[model samples]
Target: MLLVMTGIAAFPWPAATAQQKGGFRKLAPGVLTVIPPDKSSADELLHGDLLEVTEGLSGPPENLAWEPQRSPANTTLVERARNRSFARDIWCLEFAFKPPRMIEVDVPAADLKMQRKRVWYLVYRVKNTGGRRTVVDKDDPTKFKTETFETPVRFIPHFVLESLEPLSDAEELAKYRAYLDRVVPTAMEAIQRREDPRQRFYNSAEMVAKEIAFGEERWGVAVWTDVDPRIDFFSIYASGLTNSIRWRKRQGAVINPNDIPGSDMEVAMESLRLDFWLPAAGGNAAEQEMSVGYRGMFERMTLGSRVLEATGWPKTTKSNPAAALERMGLKWGDLLEPVGGGGPSMQPLEKVLTTIAGLKDPAIRTALVREMFGDVGEAALESLAAAAAGPVDTEQDKRRRAALQTMGLTPEQVAKDPYKSLARIVGAMDSQPGYAQRQAMAFKCFGPAGRRLEWLSKGAKAARALAAMESIAIDPNSVATGNAQTAFEAVRPSISALADEAERRKVLQGVFGPRGPDLFAAAVAVHEGIDHDWVFRYESDGPGL
Candidate 1:
């Protein structure tokens, strides 16, 4: 990552009689020596043998003995040649710098002392040193080689300038600003025109060392002229005056590993802050940087049709809610029948008889049916009597006849007033193996508008019973908003009486779990009605609450 240019000891100027012959010589492992082809090429030479070094070191040998040549123009000429011929190993050229001279460098007062009159030019070189060929057989303009087995190389430049003085007058400051504006655009143009694929997206970042002045820090302005526009990069102003540079060095990039996907947004915003805002603030502003990171992520997730397919969710359609419900295998009556009984309902009353009847778990079914259906309902009573009177010997048929007998309901009575006879069937649900089934059935009959609130008020003690009542009130298809509000009012007192947090949570779950949107609003209202702090605390607990 270093570039070095040094003056070498003068060597004897060769005569015309000397023969010219030069080629590469391996001086050491990975080191090579380059000899000038003729004595004329060697005359007043700053470098006699070119030495190849590795990356990471800073400069070349200090004093190799050679005959001294005596001429000023010759000295200048030799210096330029040394600068050109003193190339480092191409692989190691991550950074390059122009050697420091005794010239003056403008910088800010804070950075004035630290600024050095040295400028460095560097290009990040990615070299293909492997013997294998690439999978894609195409020429890469950014690269030096494109053929299979050819060594590919691309360069990204870096320029470093040290020790600058601040501008002394307004005119100088304006000139410096204008200069920067011109240089940045020019550098971006060069990057855009680069044909190398590897260099096409390369970005440039400038570091103005501590010694540079805000007004006079023009030491490294031209370096900004050669950067690629497409590459996203930023510059850091290292102010030496107030120890800002020290702080930056200590902080480095404040990355938190725990932040994960979201933190990358923070990093990008930080870069943007340094590039656009730091200069105006003199490097000490404390405002938090704003970013589009999460917003952008959300946009990508929701806006595009492709993301929906990727996540296994169906694309949203403009069809109305009724159409969507039908697609889900639901119908209007299925949601509304528990409140009224004026007409013949759907034939699958067994399925709609109660939530308990639909349950696969016999134990839970027994618990639910027993608590909710205390006796056979008119619907169930009719179904049972019809099955019992029919000539049937199947185990299911026997079970039905035994259920009617246990409930003290004869086949004739069951048929005469099946709905009225529901009381006895519900009572049988509370006995032995049917309790769970009764509870489940109660859940099923709790739909909105189909059943009367007066009937529900009778069994509002059990959490599941209260839940069914509320379910009927909040059914989306029902005109039971008044009933739902009344139910909420009725249940709140019972829920408040619960002594244990766990029991209260269970009641709340039943209320809110089945009718989420309605209950959410009710809960929020209750929380606010008592204390504003409660509302804040509940929301702050996040979705986990």
Candidate 2:
């Protein structure tokens, strides 16, 4: 069903008298596409009206004496054939997206009954912005001009979901699952109800390959089913939204006509790549916030999550390891269960503290602390890294230092020569990243028998337990507010009390900042462009599970 009511607009056709922001636009001179009928010609593909080819360009000039690789045997079909009167077509659509969301909707089944399914969907809006581009002028065919014109643009949307989780190079190479967009007939209506009932939304297929004229905007939703809820990180490659492309011609004595555009010929489609991170994915997880990121940012996040998970840091910190990472603005998560258990046991805080206090030797205490905090050993080893910084000039030193600062080097591998090593310089940090969070948390000591200790106490649970019992909640305003009943109470009332509302929160927070549901409502708001959702799930990271 074409839910979009294609109506005749007020703005005149392509080239109107005046151009308004959200109105119909006019086509400039030479606005027509020049993609010829025959695409089999490699020459045509390589150099269109835009006969642009980059070879040994870009990058800053460097002082070096090295032999450039020359494949003298390699030759091109048309060695010295050239044509001018060209221009590059780089038309773009204004694209913006909301974070991916899941909607439980009913779908038509084989037996004709409606089967409810969980569909993961992304919502985005695209508008033809009447962009400027260099084109061969119609008036003078030899000359070129940059004009802003809104031409008819047909959107043939192609969306592919790519997992960005890094395991090992080999495992990661084959570890990902690329999910293609699906046409879920049943999902459209359900998504609309969940999103905006007033607006019309189209799926990848339903979006007619018809020209979306200038001044018009379209909303689309690409959906997928059977997406791994266990997916920690991924990127959505949205293609066909724009008709822009870039290519690197195979440089040689001759352009081989038989050459497949794989290694040598680089044809890069201009697509919108959107990265997202689902911090928590499994059934045991909570509020799986789908965070938006640039390309590869999610990989760092997953690495943090996985590393902490492997170390069982959440258990040590007595807080949700995932939540800890988010609170500290660290892109991270801890989420995997590799079968079969028995590992070295972590000593409880009380036991560790007792043993530490009893140890007389300073060296042994230091070693034990190092054992408890592996970053200490890491810090020690990192102290000696400068010794390897042999003979190097200022440029090399600056380059190497920048590479060293990468947290797994997003794009930081310096090359003095043909140093073929994509390998990163992995070292240890002197201190863990999230160690110094000065933010105050609502804390309460629930007496001696161990408080889960809820907070990261570093063996201070014994003291917290003592404090919980000795502490009493009192309000002098009970008499003034006519709630004198609190004074008459024997134990001064439980944590939830007469003055609870005034103070405003948990017995912990009520005594401290008066403060602050859920995943679904937040997900809905995210679609509407209000991206806000962060919650500390546990009432109290207190005593028991």
Candidate 3:
């Protein structure tokens, strides 16, 4: 009996094993299943908290009867609040995302034909970091209460891959292209193998309606195809991260008492907005910095260089106004304040030359030299010459100087002989490359006309012409007067000498002569079509986004 008992005790029962040994339910006798280990604590983590700190009760208020219908004679639809807003600080989750990558996969089309398509995908993980907060109970908005049990997070993610290239600063809506997250069944297996075969990846819709409980994590990939490969900068808006929103009355939206108050308000989801710049290189995004050095302080950024870099958005520290507004759940046009304060309060550019032509001002024919070099003077001449010489390097002269310095040229060489000094180092860009730095050096110095204009000492043209132009802008009707004819007559001759040859005759005929605003209009139009708002695009292979 003792030997039988000993044998019975020694017999291994998989079902009877403790969870510490294996799983709570064993798969086999004497063989226990081990769960994969968690990621190493030592691994460098990109930490982002999706928990929103919430305050203020938005949406329709409880007891919302602005006008109650007490009788059938005054029949009205009873309004129950559609849904009470959650007054809880949005529960934050730990979020990590992988930069978008290109993967060529055998995508089976609707026709069931095996077609290889290019796919771009962003991989991300969300881990629930559970916490309790004293929040407003939805049942009674008036009463503030605390809840012990944290609500299960249902992640219904909306991933939008918006091309920054399309919304390139008020670019017309027609050229604006954006792609929604796609459901590509074929790409998953391939992405899994490429990223990590062990971890299961969920698509946008696949990950929906599932509760990620405390300490639980879910991984998902936002997939897109047919995206423009030429995009230099783009933002992948990951919404549904938090349920909190900040709203304000939409500009020019009128509020109706019968409608929900929120309907009149424009709402912005609290989301992770990540901005990326892709250099000309195939697979990298560059970081933005003061490209022209602010000495070594901003030297953290390479001068005149663009290196694409990825950034995290969820840190809670007080940030710059732009990011802070976003963190506080604000979007563009929320407050509707004019940017840069409507610029300077300068008056309209006058039709002085036109008025002069209508009068056929004869006094101005005195001498071309006197009109060009005397009355208009050196200061105004310089302004006209610089303006005519096709937008001299006004903003980047410093950057060009720095570029020259980077090219082993002294400050004196950069100032006195920028053009030739820049030439000596043109080849050095490839040998010792700093693109932005080198590109800054590449900025051509002011031309001969521009150089000559500077000889007027600070007064590019004499002060009198400039004084007339400046003061004329002060009075709305100044251009329509006899003084306007004389003033314009004096400034007209200078354009022949100063304006770009392509537009000089046009200006001389239209703006300076009997052509009036017509030819001057054409002369000005010569520069109108140029997309001066330029970004020198470049590309690189790795160490990108």
Candidate 4:
């Protein structure tokens, strides 16, 4: 028989033997001593009506190694002597089982109607060491820094048992062996992956806790009787190992009491907690019935006193009388107060205008607009164009305008179409210093829809003008086929006009490539009609080049 009783106790020093007791035998500086009930005289000590200390700092050392050769492991205790070796005069306590319990058993039934099976149980205990409090000061030795201390530890006793019964049929038994062969290697691989000792310990604890409570009382025996003839016993055990690891990994990730709550901490904790328990007992398991109970208890016991008091909902504190007049959803600059005299607090909605109007800092304004209106359509585009035309000399404004034009609106199109509200702002780009940039923007926008090529082609400087023509010809969806043909016709006369072969090849490739085959063919015809000494190389890797 194995019996173990472990707890903490403390007592006052006797005046006569005070010197012999070693002056309170400091467990900690102000903390004093921790005494344990005599292990040999436990029976007499209990009957002595001695003051039983339910809680204290003395039980076992905090750090101890388990020796396998020792018997009745619970009886082994390790302790550290009080000295100046520690920063705060702390001591460690450790307990271990020397002769580990043999918990695996095979039972035989005398009657044919009774079932025979194997049962396994693993038993272990954990001891929690209380933390300490201290005071220290760097600048002033007299003025000490005070620290509150408490042990945030709990001891848990655990046992696990698994019952295995042989299959009644030969076919099912063979299938079970085959399944085990395939799964045992994978189970070993998972076990090898858990490198942390704490992880391994916690996993073992969770399994023992779960197996001991399966389908009986919260703490009771698990039995498999009148065994099913078809169930594969080995496969069930093999798969259980894999499932147990998954359960442990998930449990380890949950937020315990050691975690501090933040603004979203509760929500995150609840989510992880729920996720952890979902596979166990199928999501509706009671708190007491799940692994979270022990973890939750530890958290509440340690940190519950420090939890912040909940306050009622906040009352609005704005003192301005006009604040009450503001609409609930009205944004910061949505004209909540009248713009001039009493018209409406806000303007009539036509489009989604960005509120960052006339912002002096272009980068700040662009960022604000992007934040508020990146998802808005034409109104945001018009507002950005207007901002670009403002006095601010910001590169962001130039980029915004370029982006707007690339989105497909020419100044003329904006002027003539129903979306002509921002016509003046769109037209202003033509006269801006970034004319080449504007022309490129116009080509990108108009070329795709085949509508604004004429305006793009009529642009300012020679270099920009040629580049605009190239942009239009390369557009896959360019609608101005005739204008594209005309531009190619105009460039054909200068193909061999004493220019570099690379530039000529580039132009030829652009016209003849995938983007504009018709234009390329037209250029070829014009070249052939002039009987120029131009050689076109066409390579065929297949039947059709």
Off by over 4 Å in 4: 1-191, 194-211, 214-411, 415-545
TM per candidate comes to 0.18, 0.41, 0.38, 0.15
**lDDT string, candidate 3, 244-363, tens digits:** 444444566544445543454454545555444443453332121101101111111110010000000011111122232233333322322122221110010011112212333345
lDDT of 1: 0.27
Report every candidate's CA lDDT: 0.27, 0.41, 0.40, 0.25
lDDT of 3: 0.40
Which candidate number has the best lDDT?
A: 2
* 1-545 per-residue lDDT for model 1 (tens digits): 01222211122212222222323122244221111111111122222211121110113342222334675542432232343322111111111111111112232236445432211122221212312211322575443321222122222222222111112211110111211222233333333343222222233433222212111111122233222222111222211111000001112233232323222221100000011111222232222221111111211111111111111111121112233223334343333222112211122222223433345665654444333433333233334435434445466445555556666765566566543344445444433233235444333322222233222221221222223333334332222223333434444455556678755544343333322222333343432122101011121222211
Winner on TM-score between 1 and 3 is: 3
lDDT at position 177, candidate 4? 20
Which residue segments of model 3 deviate by more than 4 Å?
1-86, 108-112, 135-149, 166-176, 260-262, 282-545
Query: lDDT value for candidate 4?
Result: 0.25
- Candidate 1 RMSD to the correct structure: 31.4
Once superposed on the true structure, which residue ranges of model 2 sit more than 4 Å away at CA?
A: 1-86, 108-114, 135-145, 166-174, 248-266, 281-289, 305-545
Model 2 deviation from the true structure expressed as Cα RMSD, one decimal place: 22.4
